[model samples]
Target chain A: MTPFELIVREHGPTVLRVCRAVLTAHDAKDAWSETFLSALQAYPRLGADANIEAWLVTIAKRKAIDVIRTRARTPVPVGDVPDGASELGIPDDERGEVWALIGALPDKQRKCVAYHYLVGLPHSEVAAIVGGTTDAARRAAADGVAALRRAYATIPGGTA
Target chain B: MTNIEAPNTADLDRLHDRLVHAADEAGLLDLAYRTVDTPIGRLLLAATDRGVVRVAFETEGHDRVLGDLAARVSPRILNTPKRLDTLARELDEYFAGQRLGFDVPIDFALSRGFRRDVLGHLAVIPYGTTESYAQVAVATGNPRAVRAVGTACATNPLPIVIPCHRVVRTDGSLGGYLGGLHVKRTLLDLEAAA
Candidate 1:
């Protein structure tokens, strides 16, 4: 595999997760598509010393923020919390299951989880990105994890 | 995993591994690329080690696509060529009417808020049939926001994967499609013929 492709395979999931955290499943696709499209254009100039995954994630975060900005005029309800029973016919996987729990999180907590745990951003880095203090970012991430664990606990052997 | 005060490097690594596996464990393991001759044009198909990642129509040139792979796969662009193989297989099956649904893994990280809500609802559209924007709004419990639903469909990235083509106008006319109406008609027709 080429050096570029190898890096993407290893780090792409984090970027994807970060995007998913900030955006919805469908919108995440567009944001992800756009982020990558731009990345492709900028790759040749990216410095070798740059943390490629973090750089791409920074772009994805910016793109997701743009999506939120452009669409903020409308405040559509997030709808009722999804129950596993409603999605019974769908295939079950860690992605779907984790996504379901992730969806249940409030937006800020969700983003905190995405930027911190998923993207490997430290609290300080996450704080800077979200425009808050490090402790706030850390707390949000903690809350998100706790909520996810609680939600999944009912799944029987989900996780303690 | 108790007393997880902070997500240390190991926590991040494990979460990343689990997130990637979320797709694989979902059974989306085919990756290949194929140039499919469709009614619209030569479509660019990209798959993963499991399923298709992208299906671009009338989209050509290497640099742009390579760049797309770079963003989606990120530092992992090398595996994109292999991912194309999976895209080829899935697209071939989709066009041939042999596939009912896509088992692809999509990264929906870019969208949030309203657009996300609209697109997420759009994914529930079953193959072949279509729904009006108003219906989608109503189904999503935002019955007053048909126009928002339209905007959502317009911005869908994984159009085929999310089945945004299935979202139509209340008058039963094709609205707008980011992938173009021609592709939408072809997708609708493909499902109808089945």
Candidate 2:
């Protein structure tokens, strides 16, 4: 196997995880693909003894930042919401009421919750990805979670 | 309630699972696989109709996995979660020492030429044995290609599955693992324990 493939095979997960933590899930996939492609193109120039995992993370980080920057320029329209509480294709009318509360969060808080919970990144890593300190990342994640709990409480069957 | 907010970690985790399940049912994702609860957080084993497309760490959700499958296979992407059930069983058995090697098909389209050569040889390194980069260079028909072998090992897109962890330094030290050394050690220890 080529050394690069070995590196990708070995570290694909790390790169994927970092990207997911840093970028939105929708954007994380794009960044992941770009990370490998960029690495492949830049491989010949990298020092032979360089840390491959670190290099891949750097690539993923840069790609994710670029995505955030690009998206920040022109906001994309979200999919249509059918009702005040039933937009995300919930099969049951009851379930949509609960999800609507979660979806009501600001983009930043939503991303933070997704990264902290779904991506399972530690505070330091999430901070690095989000261009903040470890403490700030943790706070943002906590606040986001707390907000969700409060929002859910407003619903009939919602519990914090 | 005066204020509403985002989901909490526990809530997000539950939602993540539900989203993945929904994606499975809706066929929204072209690849579907489970994240095995291992020493690592969760080892994701994902595959498409063509073959095994990706094996990821479970940090990313369905979005990440589906996006990867879309980019790699493009039009050929077809989510076949059931096909990977066998792989999951084998991986479980392999970790348990009941299985020697994987028999499932792999789509090596993610790699090519020299890289493919390196991992193909790395895969044959045997479960209990280790090979050095220089040794792999000799096996690849170019003794001076030790650096090339290291490069191959470094770039391998599939780690434990391709067994790149079985490759070591010529000086007989543990090499790097993208999944981190702890994971590499666990795999090595699993083989040793076997």
Tell me the lDDT of model 1 at A143: 90
Off by over 4 Å in 1: A1-45, A48-160, B1-39, B46-53, B59-76
The digit string of per-residue lDDT tens for model 1 on B97-180 reads 998787667656545788788877777778889999999999888999989888888766566777889999999999988777
Best by DockQ: 1
Which prediction has the highest TM-score against the true structure?
2
Candidate 1 residue A140 Cα shift, in angstroms, is 62
> Each model's RMSD to truth, in Å?
21.5, 14.2
How displaced is residue B111 in candidate 1, in Å? Answer: 2.5
What global local distance difference test value does model 2 have? 0.62
Per-residue lDDT tens digits for candidate 2, residues A1-160, read 1233335445665565555444444565567667766665566467758766656776776887788789986432243456545323223323544334444566556556655664566777667756678888888878878887776776676666
Q: Which stretches of candidate 2 lie over 4 Å from their true place?
A: A1-160, B1-33, B58-68, B75-80
TM-score of chain B of 2: 0.74
